[model samples]
Target: MDALHAWAWRPDGPAPAMADGPLSGFVLGVKDVIDVAGMPTRCGSPLTAPDPAAADAPAVARLRAAGAVIAGKTRCTEWALNDPAPTISPFDADRTPGGSSAGSAVAVATGGCTATLDTQTAGDVVRPAAYNGVVGLKPTAGWATTAGGRAVAPSIDTLGVLARHVRDAAAVAAAIADGPALFAPPGRAAAPRIGVLRDPFTDRVGDAVRACLARAVRAFSAAGADVHDVSTGVDLAAVHAAHRVITFAECASLHRRRYRDHAERYGPRARELIERGLGTPARDLQEAGAVRRDAAERLGSLLEGLDALLVPAVPEPAPPRATTGDSRLQIPWTLCGLPSLALPAGTAGPLPLGVQLVAARNAEPELIAAAAWCERVLGS
Candidate 1:
């Protein structure tokens, strides 16, 4: 009945009110993709066999060590793909909250928890946070360990952070990073050089979203950021195709046995994706990897003199709840394995809008710094 309160776990006992620690007193919602001891990881699908994990995921273990409460497993799209979860957004009942990390975003946005762990293969983390008016941080592909989490694509599936504030996101990130120095506060730094990405992706956005982004750029300029347009110069269509091939092929491989035996249990969308993956030739996957490498190089060149790249977190505000919303905006960065931070910029009509900041691999600190700056100046 409680959409925000998806479930609860007290693995070590009730969350304590510890006075000191990176995440002391923080209640975190873990996406169903991540394993939490004593909880059955349903992964937002009735098809999941609901296995109780033997141990906490590495990220979960790190957070628990840092004094964060293992709040519960949040809902996700079935197997972290096109299948929709049963959760609804607190902002508007009619519109989708975004997925496959929908419940995690909704929990943070609604204040049901202080923060939440999300996962992104495409826009699962960034798009949903944008739609729900929260901050979502997808660190570099391998920054946080995914040992005990369900995988969509082993190569790209990343554990991410979603919260109401950039600082909260950073704190959780640091805890999970297993490296305390990744998010050390950047003190009184000069304005960062920001790159604005535009193309067919920008063209697909609606008027309100365009205005929201324009205003955000203006705000950054007023705050002394060096902003400019930068082109990735890669064939985006091919890049997207590459991403799909990697994700679908890997997903099918991971579930090949289960899907073969219990095909009827899968939702329609999951079935479609898996079936496509099953039919894909190995040569296509190899070619997709080549495309991914090429795009990564081009993307690196685009960021040569920039601190971060700016883009709409999604094409528009949250759409009707029937769908999870478009993922086109966040796919490029995800494919490139760059760290991206999505911060609520403003609103378009009744729903929230977000802008994303992307940085090079292991450049999470820069991403966090720019996001914090935007949060302070833009007042989201």
Candidate 2:
């Protein structure tokens, strides 16, 4: 019943609103890593000073222009990395709510906000939505401007949304995207060509998640979707390895000076990542970029005839508060910079399970439509 920890700060009265548009009544929680004019962006780390920002991040500005009420700044993991936030899952207080967009997901799931602006370098947005039983949408890299936000991995870090419904998530995305039609809900496809990915990444999910995926597949088939089992054919392991190297290197690059001067201020996980990045050879970083580009091409090709690729959002339901759930299932899509959507599919006892849908780059409309259809079919 106590979820105050989810918010880093809240206004004494209603937060200011902008001219009315599609999101006139929407209440949005901005992640701590993103700037909100007049509010301090702490990024849930002691490394940052609590200085009020002069302007809003593009994502926040766009949402505000669309008439969304800025609820407050939600908590995030330190620098949106390995460290977990203090937020607790509404489903079970003893379990983790996922991270580093932990507070964003928790706010949406608990009805504290209509939607939230979040950032995802790996599985931060979708993983947390899955764990908290909400809807998450990560658009193509560069689709939503990351200006005015802290970068975890500039090359891969992306702005995203978490909402109680797929349509709400789509609305938020459409507002900030370069193309107004990016996530505008389109007419439902008569038969969505859904490709269910079967790879080492998916093979690692636990029984509950496996069963949840199976149930989703059945629902899609029953709803007249043309579902087929498929593979990306790219070396997933190599892609994941590349993701880590790139993320760490970029993060370290961003924090090099601060870390060098005050290493004691960082959490253990963040410190370890920076150290790894500091030690990584330039040749290794370049090779990782090559691997990433090659995998992106192969994965994009795999979506040639498919409306969306499906997979479990996480390996299992939210675990104990000690750590966030695994991000293996989401890393490949994120690395490829493809658009993905996560929807609550079922439950494991008291916790929730989710399925992710991915589409080719710049295919946010298709991805949103497909997710909406699945959301309907699953009755989530």
Candidate 3:
């Protein structure tokens, strides 16, 4: 059963060739959260009764224009949240590949596709890519067009790019970015100043993840990147609460009418969240928004002096295939609306692991450039 082939992946008319366009030779997988004209987007949930997309999503259309061969929809966590998808890891079917963009990351990691379109409301992009050992790029909010994609947590839903190599990740980002970015080829004669996030790596977080991150930072420094320590002074608890409110409220509003009318069709997690969201008053949402804006400003200030902030993309590598990895590390960054790139630097024993490079607001070009720099510094 060619379980991994591109199903419902071809664009309108004939297959698009990148030679005819910018992404001519590249093959891409689109996460089911976004619309792709002819596909039946199940989104790995038994509950979603989604209709066929009437038109290509704006993002999908952009990729098609670039001459990319649209591979089939990648698997995702149920409703882009906690529920695990049926998609198994290519490296070890018994282990999870991560989620909600599980399929997208695994596809690229397994070489099922060259690149993929992943959407992250929280750790969906960064976490999965880290577990699968692939690069995932989450640009600043609104930087990548979101028209035609299903709304999970609208306020925080971020469009991300997943690829096997940093160069491929950068190229796809350039094609989808606001404009052409300044690309400095990797392997610079001088080292780059990089910051290492030690809070999560010490006695505070998962040991395997921290060990892998330490090794990765050492590799970068050895290759000429000045890895250091930097801190974002914002209250993480406040940021986390703010993230929850916005995500739940937006989700509740998106399918308010239907979710209430046909409760049986939805999963336990989705239904529970909707209930929690419905309970959240408008005032709370407003407060969440205010805090989010403030958090972004503080993060901007935290990252002001550094070229990039280094952190583990996920708490640990892929857990059991049944449970998607924990998302504690990724939520704050997404809440701040900054540019983040996850590098598939090395592994944590059996499962794959990655490091995140975060830039200031609207600093995607630098994020990618720095990512390219790190890619070379780490030597694959």
Candidate 4:
């Protein structure tokens, strides 16, 4: 591994690039959890054998076809859970780069790659990108397939991208998305209507993040965008609780066989999640599903008349490497299956701070356009 510990696997020589396409010159890093032909998909876990994948995952194939070079497999939190990866923030070595897509974010941050394939169950993609000062785009759930990757939370797992710019991330996402046409070149929005989320979400963030969000709101307003405060109406705390129940239950379902036979091989956090999931009652899982649906509906309603809802991407800047920062600010949108983008807003001292922009389900085009506009305003 390099000093930053970004890559888990690198080719003996540079990976070949395609002659030409939309992403022709882009160097892409695949998250270790995702398959890349001829490379082992270790998922940052010792339990998985080092047998090379026979084929590229759908998302990887799509990006390759669009002419992105496969640089290598980047590290991920073990099983894409809470366990921290070895990668550290490029800005501050002692601070976390976030997870489970830590390597993906770090790779993009340090120019190790132009873009990276990432996934989000809770805040894997966005959080890391925020900490590393890159753009993380989590499309609406199911917009991009999760077929070839290990599942953390089957229903909520989303394929996303981490890159240095909104356009780069948007381009990578468009190439792999189910509805490619939905991501037409991100045009600058014309006086976009944006909502600044308050109460449940904002109340939890620390001073630095609050300042970052405040600056973002002001920038958008100054840029001629119609900005106003808004609420999700749904109880976000309840939604977060439901998200855990579902994530744990589904994750346990996927790893039951392996966990039962080689329990000692798993990391503490991953092991705890699996154990809790195994103990959760089926009725509770069902109820959690219900809560998810209800919350999604309410949040979707909140998006009407608004191009996007803005909020802090993380509760605070990246913390010590002992753990990934909190994911509460990101869970509600992920649970609701809305498209969200994290952009570097400003710095919290030396640490990078980000603000998230959320749009209704299947509205990635609008989300990207709005984000592009905000990216210009923030000058990030």
Best by TM-score: 4
Instruction: Give lDDT for model 1.
Output: 0.84
Q: For residues 1-380, could you state the per-residue lDDT of candidate 4 as single tens digits?
A: 99999999987776584648889999999999999999999999988989999999999999989999899999999999999999978899889999999999999999999999989999998899889899999998988789888888888999989999989988888788767777766775687889988876457878998888888888889889999988778888889999999999999999999999999999999999999999999999999999999999988988967899998899898999999889988898898899998999989788999999999988877788899899999899
Pull out the clashing pairs in model 3.
Answer: 17-24, 18-23, 18-24, 19-24, 96-321
Query: Which of the two, 1 or 3, has more TM-score?
Result: 1
lDDT of each: 0.84, 0.89, 0.76, 0.90
Instruction: Kindly report which residue stretches of model 4 are placed more than 4 angstroms away from their true locations once superposed.
Output: none
Question: Model 3: what TM-score?
Answer: 0.91
What does the lDDT come to for candidate 2? 0.89
For candidate 3, the per-residue lDDT at 192 reads 57
* Count of clashes in candidate 3: 5
lDDT by residue (tens digit), candidate 3, 190-273: 555677765532225678867777887778777777778876667777888899999998888887998878878776777888
Sort every candidate by TM-score, greatest first.
4, 2, 1, 3
- Candidates in order, TM-scores: namely 0.95, 0.97, 0.91, 0.98
What are the per-residue Cα lDDT tens digits for candidate 2 across 24-98?
Answer: 999999999999988899999987888899999988988888889998899988889888888878888889899
Steric clash pairs (candidate 1): 96-321
Q: Roughly what TM-score does model 2 have, to 2 decimal places?
A: 0.97
Lowest-scoring 10 consecutive residues by lDDT in candidate 4? 11-20
lDDT value, residue 233 of candidate 4 = 80
